[model samples]
Target: MVAQYPGMWSGRDDGATLWGKLAHDRFRYMAGIYKVHNWIDGGSGSGHNPLFAGRIEYNFLDPEPSPAYYTASTYYGKAHILAIGLAGQYQVNGVGSALQKGDYKAWNVDGLFEKRIGTKARYDVYTLEAAYYQYRTDGVCDIASSFNNHKADYGNIGGINSGTAILVSTAYLIPWRVGWGRIQPLLRYQQFRFAHHLYGPGNPKTRQFDAGANYVMDGHNLRFTFDFARYTPASGTQSDAFLLGMQMQY
Candidate 1:
């Protein structure tokens, strides 16, 4: 959920960035300055001003030692972990059309705790994670108005950008193996409150729930998931779905 948020970093874009990270003891810090929205579409209302982003984390238990600053949802009982993190992003004239631009800003706080219990031969893994986020655009981009005027792409501001969101999840990995793998059962809840309605007068809140089990064959390298989900949109019918998924990594 955090990665999918409006201002969060997910992957590369049509721009350049100067970024670095630092890790010392139980603390980790990273920051970057970006020259973004350089595409010809001119959909970011961006100018010479750069975007700034940074994150800081503190580990209360075992420190994460990944040199790439990456984190996993579950360590599969390899180690005990407890950590908290805060992140923020900001850019001038980052949202809305060039003629009606707005400054973009976002921030989030998150925490994770994972531990293994019982004897080594029959231990179970427990994980808990949560996060809160706020994203804003100074109220300059009206999505409905932009869509009606065919200016939705004027600044990549057509989606649900200005909102407050939250997520909470818990999981338990049973020690007993099922065939060649172990089972991890998890439950998650998420909610988003939009800053403004997209169409008519109504509550601008969306929610989702997920209950699932993962079959772990080789940690994150190979796994299969069976999930059931329920979703409630801001102004639509509630829906439910079942999913089966497989994941593999080198």
Candidate 2:
């Protein structure tokens, strides 16, 4: 096992990892002018489930812009998903080999798209995203699930095959005014799939609903969001999980 997961470097700037490097100005063509800001996601459970992503936004379709609410022939904004990275499942005890055992590998290849419709008062937004993930499965020596659960799988956590996964999601955004600025609410649906040859290879399907608010503050935007998911195994299992997150971008 090498020392690191993706290693200090993957050799090629754009190797096979799948993380795309796109820019936000790419969306401005449609909204006349839009801004892409940088921000971070932090909270108590932050490191518990680590995720790093670079996103950009562009405003296209707006004809005239003079500060005031000017309605062009059409007002629509586009958001480009530059890159997405994630830290897989965290296992308290497992393998010392980077991704071969303990802790899920932080697979990086991912892509996403976003769109906004309407002017200042009300608008509808939609986003589509996809990613491939390969998490860590407990080694044969471990007597519990790779997720650090109580039960043990006889299949030995499923080996390198355990981490392979494909995920996709779609979301909707609705913006409204509160006191001084505006608040945007978001809803999303997601799906995850296992490549069939992994450990314990069970087919688990999930339904998700996420809601969040975005507030603008002097060129800086602050957001808070919550997500809920219901899982239905393709075979025989019933369970549910939910997550919450907050973001700040300017």
Candidate 3:
């Protein structure tokens, strides 16, 4: 897969092309190795920065990694399941500007678990995901200042910043019938904190509470979701947001 973002120079595009293959499919243990080249070609200055990443995973209870989406049958099964993953990334010429200074890199590891209790008609669904990320930056200008300004969040905005982040989210799916679809009510909480200031002077931290429901029609391929979220930052008043969305796939 190739990830591309609109470049700061208007016409050029920043690209991170990744290639990988999944290992032997015995249904229990799986792994994949991927290499990525992140750079802005044909843009201004010297943009030859790149990053490479790899991940390995193991599943217990069931014999495979779960599907990418939660509305699939893989998640609504009658089994106690657990999956663990470890991943890392390395970067060269971390700063994408001609005035390159330092290199940036990060390591991440995560675990996911799901369990279905009782029968399909009166079952309880539980899922938990916890992840940790460690970052190392040679300097405050590690990421091109131009590039950081283009990002929408702290996670993507790189800099002379070194920090660790911990995130844990757990959601319970209660499947209740509504018309021809199944309505699954979900409750989730997430917290993220950075040891150093991610955006500026103060520590960048946020805690969010989300309540949502999904109308699963034809699984995740065709579904509707309604969610409400409240975010509490390190400072300032809490912010609230709502989302109503639909997904369609062939």
Candidate 4:
């Protein structure tokens, strides 16, 4: 939800951007300036103004040693970590129809903590993560307008507008392995509050809960997940789902 909410990559729209990052043992900073457009419709009236985005993180324990700007959700007991981050985005005339354009702005704060306990040969891994997001637009960029039109206007400007969201997750990796992998039980929750609903007149909110387990063969490189989810929406009937997924890195 955090990745999709702020329109990460500006909804993957085509454009040119200048991005850079500064990383150190104790902190990391990344920022970018983008002149994005809806090239899918030949660029049209998607505006020429630039969009600015950036994120900064401070590490209180062992620093994330990755050279990349992004960090993983967990390190699989490889490192002890305690980190907090802040991120934001802004653009003038970023959304709404051509005649009623509006500015777009979003911000979020997140934190992660991971620790390994027990003996060196049988250490258990624990991880916890949480994030909060707020997004807004100043003009007539409601859900309907944003979804119905995407060529002339940036519209929904990242699939969301004028709302707040939150996500929380936790996981515990067992110290003992089972066959080729170890089992990690996890729980996650997400909630979204929209200032304007896609239908009707009332503000709508949605909540989801997920319980799952991962078979970790080589950390995130080789893993399988089995999950069950339940969703509740302000105006819709409750729904449930079962998901099976796998991940592999070569």
**Which lDDT tens digits does candidate 4 get at residues 65-105?**
56435588899888799999998888776655555566778
lDDT of 1 at 76: 88
Instruction: Provide the clash count, candidate 1.
Output: 1
C-alpha positional error of residue 28 in candidate 1 after TM-score superposition, expressed in Å = 0.9
lDDT of 1: 0.72
Candidate 2, 98-210: lDDT as tens digits:
23324433333455455676864676665566656544434322122233341233222222323344555555554555576544444444444444444345644333334
Q: Which 10 consecutive positions of candidate 4 have the poorest summed lDDT? A: 36-45
lDDT of candidate model 2 versus the reference: 0.35
RMSD, model 1, all Cα superposed?
A: 3.9
What overall lDDT, based on C-alpha atoms, would model 3 receive against the true structure? 0.54
Poorest 10 consecutive residues by lDDT, candidate 1: 4-13
Clashing pairs in 1: 43-155
Backbone clash tally for model 4?
0
